[model samples]
Target: MSQGSSPTRETSRTDNDGNDADDDNDSALGSDQYSTASITSSTYHYRQLGGRSYPNFRDVDHWEPVDEKQQESFDIRHHIYLMQNNQKLFNAPVQPRCVLDVGTGTGIWALDVADTFPWAEVIGIDLAPIQPPWVPPNCRFEVDDANMNWTFGDGRFNLVHIRDLVGSIRDDEKLYAHAFCSLEPGGWIEHTESFMIIFSDNNSIPEDCVYHDWNRLFDEAGEKTGKSFHLAERIESSMKTAGFRVLGSRKKKVPIGTWPKDPTLNEVGLWNQHRWMEGLDGYGRWLLKYVWSLSDVDIELFFTRTRKALRDKRIHAYELYTTVWAQKPGPGGQ
Candidate 1:
C-alpha cells in the first residue's frame, strides 16, 4: 500500500565491519526509504556477517530451522502479550490506520492486528520472509530491511511496533530515534522487549549454579555481537531519550513453565518453558559458531543440559520486564 520502490543497493566496498574493502566484492545492502538513509543503513549493515544466514533467534523472522516440537512451541502462545493489550495504551480514536511491524518473525502479531482492525493496513517486515501465505485482507508481508530508509515518507505511520529485537539490533538508541521520526505527530510507538533477568524477592540464584553458567555464556555471546540480552533496564530510558512521551510501562512476570499459580500465566509459562527448551535447537545451533570462547562441544553440551533442565522443571524461571509505551506528541489537543 505505500506504493514505494525498494532502495537501490549501494556499493560500499567494505567488509562486514567498518573497515575498507575486502578482496571479494562483498558489501552490505543499503536502503533509501527515508531521507537519512546513511544512518539507518549503516546500522543495519553492522549486523550482517557476510550475509550468512542464521536460524531464528527470537522469533523475529519466520519459523526457524528447528525441530517441529520447537517450531510448534513458538506458535502455541503469544510471547508479546503487551502488544495484544494495545487498547490499554494506545488511544483508539486515532486508531492507527497504517501500522508497521518491524522484525515480525512469524507475522503472528501483525496478522492479529490486521484481523482486529479490518480497516487498518498492516505491513510486516522480516529478513527471511517466513510469514504464512494466508493472512487477513489488510495485512501483507514484505521481505525488506527495516534498518534501511523505511521506504515510506516521513511521519507516515500511525503506529509502529517493534519487539524482541535484542539479538537482531546493535544500536537501540539509533533504532528508537528513527522509529520516533517515522511516526506522525501524536502517533504511537510501541516497543516490547524482554528483560531476560526475571527475579522474585523470594528467589535467588547461586553464583555457581547452572543457571549462572547459562547467564555467563549468554552474556559473552551477546557482547560479541553487540546485542544485549539483558536490555530491559535500558528500554525506558532509551525510549524517553528518543523523544517519546512515556505513556505507560507495565511489567509482567512471564513464567518458565506451567508452574505459576495463576491459570493464564501458568499456560503462558508452560509455553515459555517449551520455547526456551526449543530455542536451544533454534539458537544454540548458531551460538557455537558466533559466540566467542565457545567450542562446538561446549554448545552441544549446553543445549542438551539446558533442554533437560527445562523439561525437568529444574529451571522454572520467568522472564521479567516492563513493556514501555509512548507517543509522539500530536498536533491537536483533545
Candidate 2:
C-alpha cells in the first residue's frame, strides 16, 4: 500500500504499525491510538508530494492532463478480486444505501462502487483533489483529510471502505474508532493494506540484496518518525479494540514481479512492477532531507535496484492483508 504516484500529480496515505518492518509516514489519518512519534512529518510530506517531484496531493492541475490516459488504462476488474474478498468478510447486503470511501485515490474504487450500486450514494474523500469531475450520478468526491476532526453526523453511513492506506493512518485503533462513530448501527467497515516484507525465500537474495537494502531504508525512516511499519499483525486486534466485531480476514502473497502462475495475478504484479519502475528513482527521493546519513542518489539507487530485482523475479514475497466487514453491534447487541 506504500507506493508513489506519477510526476504530474497524485495523493494517498496510511501509517503502519510494528507488524511490518518499514513504515512510510504518509498516512492521511493521524489518531490518538498511537503516539505522534509513530511517523515523521517530513516523510509524510514526501509521500504526499508524489515522492520527490510533486509535493502536493491535491494538485488538480497535475492530473487534469492525464484524465483520458487514466480512464483508458483504469481497470476496475483487477480490483474486483480484492474488493470481492474484502466484502466477503462483511455480513451486509451486496449493496448498501450509503457508502463512504476514505483516501479515495483517482476515484476508481468510489466510481466502481457507485456504478455497482446505482441507488447508493457514494462519497469519496481525499486530501488531493485529483479525482476526475466526471463521476457517476450517485458518486461524489470531497477534498478532505480523514485524520482531522470530521464534520459528519453520527451513524450516518451504512458502509465505510478504506484501502491501501497504510501510509496515511498512524493510529489504527483510533482511526477505526472514529470511523465506527460515523457508521450507523451494524454498518460495515473494510480495510485493505499491504505489509513491506523482505522479498525473498530460502536463497535467491542475500542479506545485502537491494530488496533488503530498500527494506532497511524504509524501516529506519519509519522508526525515526515513530510510525509502525508492522501493522499487518495488528489489524484484527485494532478492529476489536475499536469495538467492531471481526467478520473475516484474507491474506495473500503478492509476488514482486510477473512471476505468478496465474495470468490475472501476473498482470496485477506487472502493473505494480511497472509503477515502481516508472517512479524508480522517486522512492526515497527525499531521504537526504529527512535522513541525515543517507544521500538522495543512494536512495535512488536502492529503489532502482529493488525495481530491477522485482522485474527479474529474484524475490517473490509481499504480504496482502485484507480484513472485511467489521461492525458495531446494534443497541443492546454489544
Candidate 3:
C-alpha cells in the first residue's frame, strides 16, 4: 500500500485558486501524498457529505462518492465498457511506453492496461484516491484534478485516456487542449462519455415517464452548472480544433435491462441494468440536490421510481455513449 493509503484515502491536492478554506476544512487535514507536478494543496481533504463520502480533491465542487459501494459501481461500469468496446481497453492503436488514464475511477482500466503492456508506465489520475495499492509494478495512481491546469510536463505520454466523465467537466475544450499539450507528438488521446439521457426505439417508455423528468432536470442542472451531460457529442469538434487528427468516432446504444433479444445485447443489458440500479444514489445525488434543489427524501423517492422503470424490460430503453480518438501530428502518427 502507498504511504498515505487509508480507508479514508488521504491524497495530495491541486488547489486552483490557492484558497484551501472551504466548508470541508480540507486544508486542516494532513497531506499524505504529493502531485507529480506543482499543484499546491488547497482543499484536499476527504469529505463525508449528506452521509456519502466524496473524493479528497475538488473538480467542479464535490459531486461523486468514493465509498466501497460506489467503487464497486465504478468497476462494474468498467466491465460494461469492455463489453461495449469489444474487450479492448482502448481503440487507439499505439504501443505506448507511457500512458495516462484521466479520471481513473478505482484504477481498474489503468491496471488492466499496465498488465496488457508490462513495459508501459501507467498512471491513473483522479480527484479521489480510491484505487487499491496492489497494482502492477508499472502501474501507479495519482490524485489530481483534470479541470485544473495540468503540470505533467509537455510531450510526456504516448496515450492519454479519459472515460466516464459525464456532467463533470465545465470546460472540456480546455481539458482536451491540455491532453494535446501533454501528449508526445505522435501520441493518441482517447475519450469516452455516456450521454445521460435514456431512449426507447418502440416508444415503450410512456410519455409521462419518470426518465423524462430526470432528463429535464439534468438539462436544467447542466445549464445551471455549465457541465453538460451531453458532452460526448461535442468532443469531436473540440479535439479537431485542438490539432488532433480526428479518427472515426464510436457510438453505442447500451440497453438498460435485458430487453434485447440478441444474446450479446441481452448480456450487456443485464449488466447495464445492474450498473445503474446499484449506483443510483451516487449517480445523480449531488446534481439533483445542489443544482436541481431537490431534498434528500425527494431524491431517494425519485431514484426508487427510476430503478423500477429501468427494470421494466418492456420499456426497452437504452443510453447512448460516444467515443473519440485522435492522433497528434508527428512521426508515427496514425
Computed on alpha carbons, the lDDT of every model, listed in order, comes to 0.59, 0.57, 0.78
lDDT of 2 by residue, 191-294 (tens): 76666565545466766677666566666755665455556667778988989888767666655567767876676676666545554444445443465455
Q: Evaluate candidate 2 by giving its C-alpha RMSD to the native, one decimal.
A: 9.2
Best by TM-score: 3
Point out where model 1 deviates above 4 Å: 1-26, 29-73, 76-94, 198-201, 204-207, 313-316, 332-334
On lDDT, the candidate that comes out on top is: 3
Query: In candidate 3, what are the lDDT values of residues 1-334, reduced to their tens digit?
Result: 1123322224334455454423244432232122333222432355666777776553336566877778888888889889988899999888979999998888889999999999999988877667886788898887666776677789999999999887678678888888999999899999988887888889999987888987887788778777677787788988988899997679999998998999888999998888888788887788788887889899988898998898776798998898888999998886
Between candidates 1 and 2, name the one with more favorable lDDT: 1
Model 2 lDDT, full chain set: 0.57
What TM-score fits each model? Answer: 0.75, 0.72, 0.87
Error of 3 at 37 (Å): 7.7
Cα miss at 36, model 3 (Å)?
Answer: 6.4
Counted clashes in each candidate structure = 7, 35, 0
